[model samples]
Target chain A: MSHTLHREGRRRDLRGEFIVMSMAAKGINDAGAGPKLRRFLRIARKHGAVSVSDVKSVMHAVFTDIGAVESVLRDLRRARLGLSVTVTGLVAPIHRACCRSEVAEEPHTVAHSLGVWGNRRRLPSETVLSVMTMCGHSLVSVPLVEQAVASVRAGVCSPRAAAVKLAEPCVCGIFNVDRAARLIARLARSGKRR
Target chain B: MVQISKSKCVCCHRCALFCPVAAIRSGRDGASWIDEAICVECGVCVRNGCLSGAIRRRRSPWPRSVRALFSDPVTKHRSTGVPGRGTAESKTNDVTNRIQPGQVGLNVELGRPGVGTSFHQVQQVTRRMAKAGAGFEEQNPLTHLMSDRRRGVFPRELWPERVLSVVVEASLPLEELAGVLKELRAVERKIGTVFSVSVYCRWADRRRMLALVDRRRLLPQAKVNVGLGRARRQR
Candidate 1:
């Protein structure tokens, strides 16, 4: 028998675990068993390949194969929404997983206390952090990047200084500071605030 | 396959209760049996749901090693001897010297959620990049599959193998960025599933990329990562 697909319009699932209530109340089960919540999130991120950051919209279907996933992705594109089903995975229905530890920001290993971690005044704000953390690898957050874009746009920061500032956060060297500078320049000048 | 030990399984069916793909079934004896065909080896049951430590992974032979490759975070990739996905290509480039000054590395990922790649999508890329004289990063998982790094070919035996995602990594001259983008787009419609591409370059290289991106309308979805953790040239 083919798998049943469930469609959930974009909901901000930061942890990717919240369950659909109607299905849960009906005992969302496959065969005789159900899917666990943690399993759902894992399958979703690894399989769906949708940027979990500011996803804006999502089309979730379970028990579906590549053909079905592809169809839904095509449908979303047809709807003029910017979404692509890059990956797809399974998610079970039962809850009981506290998975925050699995993907928490790396700051936890160094800071002895949650308070200390939160008090990291040097860290970027929720607005910027929300934007920066979308990369998942944690190499892209540079205060100098935003500052450099603004400065370079205003002729206040030299291009050289801007490059240094942009490169500062890239310890892993994967973060493309160069492309970002250009985007930032455009965004800053346009006042787009991205 | 994910096995639920008969001796250990309580028949609570808790572990199988929420199987996303219906891979688990109640046996005649009330024990849990996971269908090999349906199982994606996601490990969610063993990690979070198993209460009696009853669920265990049977040793995956040769090609299924692909599953273990992406599933088990600690399993060191045989080809590169690096643990967990591309020597942390994005995580350790500064230390590894995989990326260099005036150059950028492009990491392309091809993936499925449960069912994995058959090495077809990956081969398309390796062939193209190798043809371009680009070098695949030694520590990357996809490079591990390459029997000929220069040809971007995986071992013939691995052609049917599957995994969650494969990162094919290559470093190139910054000027080749557009060409790389073009190459990827050429193969975009050929694959069965979807993918993402990341270009790793220096801060000084952003303007040129921006120009290319604007002209070509490529990588509008790509996220820019500035390594905030790196030692600053200024500070």
Candidate 2:
């Protein structure tokens, strides 16, 4: 199929999910999902970049039925599969997953990988904190920075493990563990690892 | 000069919602119309706010009927304000090009210069102008324009430009100062023009403001001017 056709199909699929998610979350009978998604997509494409915040805002407005898992899947599929999804929004889902995971080992690995792959583009504080809390850290701060050393020590998850888990679904690009580790260490010192 | 078609408007109200001046109004037909007199012509609504092509922009008034006039330097300069064909060179010449050390806080009067201004006022104005300059550099023109007048440069270039004398009023917060500097650096990359800031403050507080300027020609032309009556007393 032509790229345009492929994108239209994917948009239709996303529109469906957006409707389902909105209905589930808001308990509303409104059928404006398709229009809303189209609007969001149009704006995102026009801007050429979408932030995690953008996805979260739309998802929240849609009533959060688009859970972290589905969103992450969508983002990963978009990024790895070249699905023409919003770039920042695609990264947002994975970042959201990293925040919600309960396996003490996964969140840190994801954070490190994200830091390396995303480079200096900082992830939203909520996403970082969600990941930290998922790995068993306290939720004392809604969007505050947590001490990397304390969080890691509390969770007992190594950085290498975190990187590996994050790199798995990223089919398009390989994550460099060494680079991730170094970036993580630097971020930790600068109190920015989160 | 754009007309919004009511039939095509979705009544998303995005245009009215984001109008900086709140000039857009929703009509009975569900389309938004701009109050032409109050519309600042910022174009924010036309650019980012309008999702539907309902807004149609009309060109501004024309100056002439002849085609040859387009190449005339005087006509072009009069039309654009910035000199025709030599905008880059003219901008370079408009301000003193030298970046003098310890000049960051120099208090230089922009626009019509007059009295009743104290050192404290000058410092305040300079600080605000610097912050605004920084904000402009950061590509956060909205924030810069909306920032406290004491910490922002009154963009004389903006349409419907008002004539108001600017004076440095007071010292700004340190973090804000740093943010302003960072913004200036960022702007330098975009506009290719370095801003020369002027700082003014009480003689006793001079050192403090000077420390902030930090020997950079970013701030220069520091001076003290007596208020209207005080100027006569000194004379």
Top model number, TM-score = 1
Question: Which is the leading candidate under lDDT?
Answer: 1
Candidate 2 lDDT by residue in tens digits, A15-132: 2111111101121211334454444444333333211112212221111223533443334333322111211112233334334432111111000000110011222342342232
lDDT of candidate 2 over B107-220, digit per residue (tens): 222211111112222233345445555322221112233234436533433323211122122223433444454443444343211122333333233345446544633211
TM-score of each: 0.48, 0.25
Consecutive 10-residue window with the lowest summed lDDT within model 2 chain B: B226-235
lDDT of 1 by residue, A1-194 (tens): 00011111122322232211001101112122123323333444554432122110112223223333333333333332111122212221110111221111211000000010111233443333332332223223233345555677788876555655544332222222333344455555675442
For model 2, what is the alpha-carbon lDDT of residue B155?
40
Worst 10 residues of 1 chain B by lDDT: B220-229
